[model samples]
Target: MRYLSLDNQRDGFILAARVLMMVLFVLFGWQKLAGFAGTVGYMASVGAPLPTLSAIIAVVVELGFGFLIAIGFFTRPVAIIFAVYTVATALIGHRYWALTGMDQYMAMINFYKNVSIAGGLLLLAVTGPGRYSVDGK
Candidate 1:
C-alpha cells in the first residue's frame, strides 16, 4: 500500500475537515431558525439570558460563521471564534455535573463532544483552510 504525499493530500484533507466541522453548526442553526420560538423557549429553559437574543446569536454564529468556515473565508479568525463559542456552549448548556442518571451521562457526552469539536476548530485556526479555500486564494 502506498500513502499519498503530504503536499498532495493537504488541501483535500483540509476541505474534508472543514466540511465535517461545519455540518453540525449548519444543521443545528437551520433547525433553530426553523423552529425559532421553540429554540427561544429552549434557550430560556437553559437559563440563557435574553433567550431570543441568544437564539439569534446562536443562529448567526452557527449558520453564518459555519458557512464562512466551510467556504474557507476568514478561516483562522472564524475557527477561533467558533472554538471559543463551542467551549462556552458546552459549559453553559451541558452542565453534566449538575445532572443525574441518564441526563448526566448524556450531558457529559455532549460536553466532551463539544470539547473535541473545539479542539478541531483550534487546529483549523493553526493550520488554516489550505489551498482549496477562499482564504487560501
Candidate 2:
C-alpha cells in the first residue's frame, strides 16, 4: 500500500506538471501566431534585435517543445531547452528592468520567478515524467 501510494503521488506530480506545461505552451504558442504584431512589438520592446526570429523561436519552442512535454516524448531535451530559454529571457529582458532602480521591483521579482521556473524545468529534465508518462511505458 505504501508503494502504491508513492506511485500515485509521483504520477500525480507528473500529470500536474505536464498539464501546466501544456496549458502555458499552448496559450503562448497561440498568442505568438495569432498576435504576431504584438509578439514582434514585445520582442522589440525587450531590445531583441530580430523580432521576426524571436517570434519564430517563441512559436516553435512553445508549440514543439510543449507538445513533447505534454506527451512525455523527448521530455528531458524539451525541458532542457525550456530551462535555457527561461534563464536567457530573464537575463536579457528582466535584468534591465531591475537596473532601472527600485521603481521596477516587480522586474526583479519576475526575474527570480523565471529562475525558479528554470530550476523546476531542470529538475524535470533530470527526474523525467515519472511512471505516469508515455515514455515510462
Candidate 3:
C-alpha cells in the first residue's frame, strides 16, 4: 500500500493493536472478578505480598484500565501504566529462578510472555490510540 493509503488506515491498525493488547488483561480480570476467592488464594499460593490487595489491584488494572485502553481513552498514560503493571506481574508472579523442572519452565514462559506484553504496551504508549479513540477525538 502507498504511504497515504496506509496512513488512512493508521487508526484501524492502532485500534486493532490496542484492543488486542487489552484482551489478556480484560479476560483474566473478568475471571478474577468471577472467582475472587480463588484469585486471592492463587495469589497467596504464589507468595504474592498482600494477596488480597494484589488481587484487587489486578482486577482494577486489568478490567478498569484495560477497558480504557479498549476504548482508546487515556491511551498514552494508560498504556504506560499497563506496561509497568505487566512487568511487575512478571517479576512478582513468575519467578522462574525460584522454581525447578516443569514448573520452572512454565514460569519462564509466563515471565517472558508478560515481558513481551509490556513491550507491546510500551509501543502503544508511543503510538497513541489513533483517530478512533476518545483521546484522538
Estimate TM-scores for all models: 0.95, 0.83, 0.93
Clashes of 2: 0
lDDT of 1 at 2: 56
**Model 3 lDDT tens row, 1-137:** 45556776889999998888888899999999999999999999988989999999999999999999999999989989989999999998999999999999999999999999999899999988999999999
How much lDDT does candidate 1 score? 0.95
Reference-based TM-score, model 2 = 0.83
Clashes of each: 0, 0, 0
Better of 2 and 3 by lDDT: 3
Local accuracy of candidate 1 as per-residue lDDT tens digits, 26-126: 99999999999999999999888899999999999999999999999999999999999999999988999999999999999999999999999999999
Of the pair 1 and 3, which is ahead by TM-score?
1
lDDT of each: 0.95, 0.81, 0.93
Candidate 3 Cα outliers beyond 4 Å, as residue runs: 1-5
Tell me, by TM-score, which candidate is best: 1
Per-residue lDDT of model 2, residues 1-137, tens digit only:
25456554877788788868577767878888899999989999888769889878888887877777887888888899989988987887687454766746878887898888889889889989777677888
Candidate 2 stretches greater than 4 Å from native: 1-7, 96-103
